[model samples]
Target: MNPGVADAALEGGSAPVGPRRGRLGRPSWPLTILMIAASLTVLVPLYFTIVMAFKSPAQIGSGSGLEFPSPIVWDNFARAWEMVGFGRSLMVTALITVFSVAGAIVVCSMVAYAIARNWHRRAYKVAYIYLLSGLFVPFTVLILPLIKLTAMLGIDGPVGVTLIHIVGGIAFNSLLYIAFLRSIPLELEESARIDGATTWQVFWRVIFPLLGPMNATVGIFAFLGAWNDFLLPQMMIANPELQTLPVVQQLFQGEFNTEYNLAFASYLMAMVPTLIAFVFAQKWVMSGVMRGAIK
Candidate 1:
C-alpha cells in the first residue's frame, strides 16, 4: 500500500470541514443577537424599577425615567418600607410561602411516587387522572366558594391562604414530580425493600433524596406564586396587619392618584427576596426543568 494512502486510511479518510451550524441550521450570530435583544427587553423594566426605587420623589417627577438618580436617595426605601409595613408583610409572606411550598412538595412528591410506582394498576391511573383534573379548574372559579368555606371554618386569614396555595400548587408540582419519578429506576426501591425496608422507609431513604432537583424547581415556583399572589390574600384576609407584600404594596396606589416613586420602591423591595432565591437555586431549577422536559 502507498504510505500516503495508508496514512489517509489510518486517519479515517479526510473529511472537508464546514462552518458550524446551530440546531436550526442557521448561523449562530443572528440567534445570539436575537437572544441578547430579548433579554434586554425583559430587563429594561426591571432596571427602570430599580432606578426609580432609589430616586427622590422630586427627581422621579422631573427627571427622565430611564436616567440614574442624582445623589441617590435611600429614603424612598425607608418610607416605602414603613408605608407598606414591609417588616410585617415580609414575615407574613415568608410564613405563607414557606408552609405552602413545604406542604406542596411533601404531599405532591409522596402522591407522585405512589402513582408512578403503581402505574400498572387501573386504580392508580384513575387516581392520577382525578388529581390531574384539578389543573383544569381555574382558581378564580373557586375563589367565591373558597371564601365562604374559609369564613365558616374560622380560618380565613394567612392559614386559609396558605392552605389554598398548597392545594392550588399540588396538581402541577405533582405532574412534574411524577414525570421525573417515572424516569427513576425501580431497582433502587426494590433493593431497599429486599433489605427489609418498609414501603415508607424505601421512599424516605432511597427515593425522596433523588428528587432534590424537582423539589427545588417546585419550591421556587411555589414560593414565587404564593409570594406574589394578590387576589387570594386580598380576598381572604381583610385585616391590615395580615396582608402579604403584593397586597400591601397596593396600598400605595389610589383610585384617582398614585405615588409612583414609593410604589416602585415597594415593588423593588418585594422583588429582591425572590430574585436572590432564584439566583441561588437557578442551577437546580434549570436541571429540574430539563429533566421534566425530557421525561
Candidate 2:
C-alpha cells in the first residue's frame, strides 16, 4: 500500500464518532414557532393598548387599532390621570399594597417559621393544616359575609381592604416561606440559640435576613394581588372617594358607552407601577421560585 493511502486510512480510522442522534437532537422548530406565535398573541393586545393610550380620542376612533399614533398625545396621560383620580387612587392603592404586603410578610413568615421549626410536634402540624386549609377556600365563597363583616366593623375602605389582603395572602405566602425555611440549615439557627439568642432574636437577626429572595417573591405576589384587586374593594367600599385604582377606573365606563382612549390611558397608567416593580424584583422572583422548587 502507498504511504499516503496508509496514512489517510489510519487518520480516518482514528477519527471520533459523533454522539448518536435522538428526537431531542433535532431542533424543535414547531415548538419554537408556536412559542413565538403565542408570545405575539399575548403581546398584540398590550401593543394595541400602549398605542391607543398615546393616541387622542379622534385618532383612536379614526385609525386602525394596530396602528401607531400619528402624533403622540401627551395630554392623554394627564387627562386620564385626572379622570381616574390617579393621585388619590394611586395613594390609596400604594398605601393598601404596602401595608398588606408588609403585614403578610411579617405575619406569614412568623407563622411559617413556627410551623417549620415545630413540624415534628402534633399540635404544630395541626396548626399548619389549619393555616393551609385557607388555600382550599375560595374568596368568592366568603364575599358576601366578608362584606357584611367589614361593614359591621366600619372598616370598609382601604384599611379593610388591606386587612383582607393580609389575611387572604397568608396561606400561599406561608407555604412559600415554609418551603424556603426547610431549605435553611438547622445548625445556623441552633448556633444562634446556643449564643443566648431568643427564638425571636435568632429569627429576626439570622433567619429573616436570609429570606431576602423569598421576601421579595412574597412581596411581589402580595403587591400584585392587592393592587389589581377590584372585587373586594368594590364590594366593601361604596364611597367613590375611598375606592382603589381598579375600582375608580371602572367608573370611567358606562353600561352603554365607553371612553376607549381614556380607558386605555388609565389602564396604561395603572400598569406602570406594577411593571416597574416586576422589573426590579424579577431576579429575586426567579431565584426564589427556583429555590422553592428545588426544596
Candidate 3:
C-alpha cells in the first residue's frame, strides 16, 4: 500500500474541516429555558406561602411578599400551635393515618393476590370487573349513604372517620396492587405450590417479599390521603377535640380571618410529616408506577 494515499483515505480525504463549536452537539437551550420557566411558576408561589407562614400578622399585611421579612417572627409557630390545638389534632391525625394505611395495605394486597393469581377463573373475572366499575362512581354519590350507615352503627368521632377512609380506599388502592401483582411472574408462585406449600404460605413467604416497594408506595399514598381529608372528618366528628388537621385548619381560618400568618403557620406544621414521607417514598413510588406501566 502507498503510505501517503492510505493515510489520506483513512481520514476521509480531510477536506475543509469546519469550526469545532457546531460539531460538539450542544444541548438545546430552548428546552432548558422552558423547564426552568415552568419550575419557577410553581416554586415562586410555594416560596411566598412559606415566607408568609413565618411572618407576623402585621408584617404579612404590610411587607412585600417577594422580599425577606424585616424581623423574622419565629413565635408564629408557637401561637399557631395553641390557636389550632395542635397537640390534640396531631394525635387524631396520626391515628387516622396509621389505621387507614394499615387497613388499605392488608385488604388491598389480599384482594389483588386473589385476583391476579386466579385471573382465568370466571368468578374472579366478574369480581374484578365489579371492582373496576366502582372506579368511575364518584365518592360524592356514596357519602350520603355512608353517613346514614355510620349514624346507624353509632360510629362517630376519629375512629369512625378512620374506617371510612380505609373503605373509600378500596377502588384505587386495589387497582394499584392488582396491576403490580400481575407484573410478577406466576412461575415463582407455582413452584412454591409444588413444594407442598399451602396457598397462604405461597402468598406470605413467596409473593409477599416482592411486594415491599409497591406496599410502600401504596401506604404513602393512603397516608397522605387520610392525613389531608377534611369533610369526612367534619361530618363524622363535630367535637373540636376529635378533629383532624385539615378539618380544624379550616375552622382556624374561618375563626381567625385576620390572622393569615398564624393559620398558615399551623397548616404548614400539619404538612411536615407527609412531605417527609413523600421524600423518602418517591423512589419506591417511581418503581411502582413503572411496574404497573410494563406490558
lDDT of 3 at 200: 95
Q: Model 2, residue 290: what's the lDDT?
A: 45
For candidate 1, lDDT tens digit of each residue in 1-295? 5656544442332221223234465568988999999999879999999998887777878877899987698888888898878999999999998899899899999999999989999999999999899989998899999999999999999999999999997788899898778768988888889899999999899999998878877887787789889999999996879999888877876885456778898899999987887679665555544444443
Q: Is candidate 1 or candidate 2 better by lDDT?
A: 1
- Residue 216 shift from truth in candidate 1, angstroms: 2.4
lDDT of 2 by residue, 1-295 (tens): 5757644543333222233335366768999999999999878988988998888777877867789887888888888888778899899888998999899889999999999999899999999899889999999899899888888998988899999999998888899899778779999989899999999899899999998767877887787789899889988886888789888877667895457878888988888887786678665555544443343
Better of 1 and 3 by TM-score: 1
Off by over 4 Å in 2: 1-34, 255-258, 289-295
Model 2 has a clash total of 0
Regions more than 4 Å wrong, model 3: 1-25, 289-295
Best by lDDT: 1
- Cα shift from native, residue 3, model 1 (Å): 48
